[model samples]
Target: MSIVIIQGPHAHGLASGELQRNLQPLALAAGRTLEWFRCHELRDFVACVRSAKRRASEFMLLDPGELGLQAMAHPEAGLGDALDEVDTPYVEVHEDASTELGIQPGQHHAPVATVIINGDIGCSYRIGLGIALRQLDDEGIAVRAA
Candidate 1:
């Protein structure tokens, strides 16, 4: 399957490169394809989702990071609305999301997301991608187009 991962700017010094390193190998070995996009703004986040959906990717992995706060602040019809309109099934990703970290869980309960995966840095991305790929496989969706 082909999945799109939308990553937001990390807070608390988590490096974004760590996620890619973990996910890319797993995907390649599984005969899956991945597209990773890092978004620093709400508009870019929404557009990346639209781009992924338009490209017919089977699933999306979203890690809104610090941007989650921005989304929660405007839940009435802002980023959440954009996500709803895009209509791509997504799993919310939280890297290094231990409660001891005290990060606000803004998008955890987002209505549009299929699931939320929280784990150590880099680990959550791998797990979220696995879950998304399995969900699509369970649904009998074909692997990504060549």
Candidate 2:
């Protein structure tokens, strides 16, 4: 399955990069191949998701800060309202997640430990990624420079 990971700006330090790297472990453990697209801009995120949808049967958009949540939290913030434009489902990885997700402070670069995944997906690979993501979130880990 093709997964487009939307690393929102809220993802501080190297969280985005760390998230990208950690996907490998999830793929390895699941014995599945995952096509990941990392994006920061809203336009790029939308394009990547759209592109993935066209090519893959399953698609996922992961934003740790709850891209939609943040948007909805603010009525005047067009960002929250823009969530409606995304047709696909998404999973919001919270700032304070579980330790099993391998989150830690002052960590730059993806965590080598087991990945913590969370979110919605139909494929097994996506499931693994979700678990890994969760681990990362819980640990409060990041990929920024030490």
User: Looking at model 2, which ten-residue stretch has the lowest summed lDDT?
Assistant: 99-108
Candidate 1 residue lDDT tens string, 1-146: 68888887776766767767877888887677888888888678767866775778877888777776666565542565565556677777775343111222464224223333454646666667778767776666544542
Tell me the TM-score of each prediction against the true structure. 0.74, 0.44
lDDT of the candidates, in the order given:
0.66, 0.42
Best by TM-score: 1
Candidate 2: tens digits of C-alpha lDDT, residues 68-146: 3443344354333233344444443434333122223233122223223333212323444565545434444454433
* Error in Å for residue 75 of model 2: 9.1
RMSD of each: 5.5, 13.9
lDDT (Cα) of model 1: 0.66
